[model samples]
Target chain A: MATEAQGESGGGLEFHPMDQFIVSPLFGDGGVAWYTITNATLWMALAVAAVFALLVMGTAQRQIIPTRMQSVAELAYGFIYKMVEDICGKDGVKYFPYIMTLFMFIVFSNFLGLLPMAFTPTSHIAVTAVMAFAVFIAVTVLGFVKNGAGFLGLFWVSSAPLPLRPVLALIEVISYFVRPVSHSIRLAGNMMAGHAVIKVFAGFAAIAAIAPLSVVAITAMYGLEVLVSFIQAYVFTILTCVYLKDALHPHH
Target chain B: MATDTHSSAGDGVAAASAPGMPQLDFSTFGNQIFWLVLALIAIYLVLSRMALPRIGAVLAERQGTITNDIAKAEDLNKRAKEAEAAYEQALADARTEAQRIIAETKVGIKQDLDAAIAKADAEIAAKSADAEKAIAEIRAGAMDAVRDVATDTVGEIVTAMGGKADPADLAAAVQARMKG
Candidate 1:
């Protein structure tokens, strides 16, 4: 009975036993254990490479009216321009290029994960965590440089009365610290959950008698996931704008 | 799950390919992160320098086209107004010329009537002087003829009477008769 239970526990197929990347501690056959690379890292590099190649090729053939490559380039620029204008106002025009690149990187990374055999970099907490931390650091530093020590007053929120100052400051400080954690987790969690669900459903459908229905469900979910992926990218970029706005104008 | 099958396969790969393969870690991802940042910077530079300007030029070109269209419309309207003014001026000149011709004709008719009246008055005065001269001439001739006739009649009467007396006797007789 024990053997049977053990056999059953280890039976059938389980997709993705490890995280997106499985790191090994050694370099070759026999060596001291050092470090390993994750698949998420691989996908991230792929996304970056793909983006670089696309930009290089897109600009190579510069048609006056615009070819397919030029159109793609124009679409990227125009989309980011509208986003900055809407979220950060006219003053945000200066940051248009940065925000546009960030949006495209996230979008491409998220879409790459949706493929059959591709890894999703966004599903990993560390990747999103680092990116979020960078944003936090940048905005915080900018606020200080722009407003001096008065930037600290952002927590106290000068509008608070003397009696309520300490309590409000404590809450504000907590929320400020929570920013990076939430920002990173929101993207990581959504991506991880979506991919996990798709894998599980695919596994169930693979062995089921009515597999066709499950395929349909999977197909529908994929379409929905694509939409969510775009929305997530847009949300991330807009939030970045909002945070930068706070840095630029510390009152809010 | 499926570890039993994977264990044999894993053992095969782990043993045949590489012996005693160590586990992986998060630090291996560091290099990747570095390259990613570098690539991101490169992409950013390309976008800022190349892509953005093209987009700006397209927008600027669109704006310029609109402004040019507006300027053209304004110019056309100005020209139309000038043409309208010119047409009105020409019409006014034509009317003024027609009025002047009518006025000149009226003055010409009045001048003709005044000249004819002066000519008729001179003609009537000349005809009246000629009639008066003819009347005076006839009156003188009639007087002379009547005196001559009377003298001849008296001579004839004296000769018929066979009077051989001198002219002095005749003159004395006439004077005595007149005094009586």
Candidate 2:
């Protein structure tokens, strides 16, 4: 849909890099309501299906000696499990399933989005914002519940001198509130930026003189995006663990 | 060309008002969020309910299997060591028993030899004593027979020479001669 821009009209070179992110209805040229199945839904569904195929059906045998898919499933399990345990400590292991869910969803969505003409759900601020806010809210509530009034100690800056504690506390509070915003934006920004750059480069291929350079740029950007996709997912998961750690033990 | 440019310029303004960045379009946020929440929930359910527990069990089972195999191997090794010790003890016991028997047999043979040697020595001493007594008796008998022969020879000579008055006188002469 985006590449079909002004092909018949022999006008100036047209470039609509951001057009790929449009959330149009899959069935028709209609409006996108909250429950409507758009390209976003299709990709999200694909990501879910991919998760099921990898983790669920792949480990159906539950063998001591694992198959390739089973091994990968186990690796993903172990990687996230270790991450949760390390950042959040052993006590934080209870929340491992939630962290794994976020990691697998983002990672899969990212990798799947690498396919040609595919929509990246994680690239959207709305999607990333919701997940980040969910994590933030959950961690905050857990901190309060687990530690009671002591959870506010996260912002109290007990390590500082008593005179400096108030200022430090204010700064900590601001930073604490900003965590979800930064967390969501970081992922969404990285994914969106890489994809947009690649699209911009792809648009330049309309010129016969610089087609090779554009292709090369696209290739490099595509490779970087692949790395970015996984890393962004990883950063998101690790940050969640960090937040969870703070909730579990907010003193330090 | 002028008409085309004007039309394109109007389209650009329209596009700008609608916004080129789809991410900034607030109208679609609800839709994206709704689908994302649904996807996350689906992923969460599938993972927590089915996949994770199975993977965990398989990992746990593999660990347990390894531990059990190692334990079994160690147990067998201990049993083997015990068997070797038992065999060595049996061998040592047999050797001791044989040594004791040999010592007893040697002692018995020595005792029997001493007894035989003592009995033969005593018999030899007794025979030597009896032979010495018989030799003294034979010497005495020889002396008596010599005296009788001398006396008879003197009597016959005296009778022949007609110088003897009686046999008693001749006996007396022989006895005197034997005594000198």
- Interface root-mean-square deviation (Å) of every model: 7.1, 4.7
- Candidate achieving the largest DockQ: 2
For each of the candidates, the C-alpha root-mean-square deviation to the true structure, in angstroms, is 11.4, 7.3
DockQ of each: 0.11, 0.35
> In DockQ, how does model 2 score against the reference complex?
0.35
Check candidate 2 and list the clashing pairs.
none
Give all TM-scores, in the order shown: 0.64, 0.75
lDDT of 1 by residue, B1-180 (tens): 344234424444443333221122344346445545754676677667765675667656656877898999999999999999999999999999999999999899989988998888898889878888888888877755654454455556788898555556655565565457
Query: What is candidate 2's lDDT per residue for A40-154, written digit by digit as tens?
Result: 9999999999999999999998888899999999999999999998888999998999999999999999999899888898988989999999999999999999999999999
Return the top candidate by lDDT.
2
Interface RMSD of 1: 7.1
True contacts kept of each: 0.21, 0.85
What's chain A's TM-score in each predicted model?
0.83, 0.95
The TM-score of candidate 1's chain A against the true chain A comes to: 0.83
* Candidate 1 docking quality: incorrect, acceptable, medium or high: incorrect
State which candidate has the highest TM-score: 2
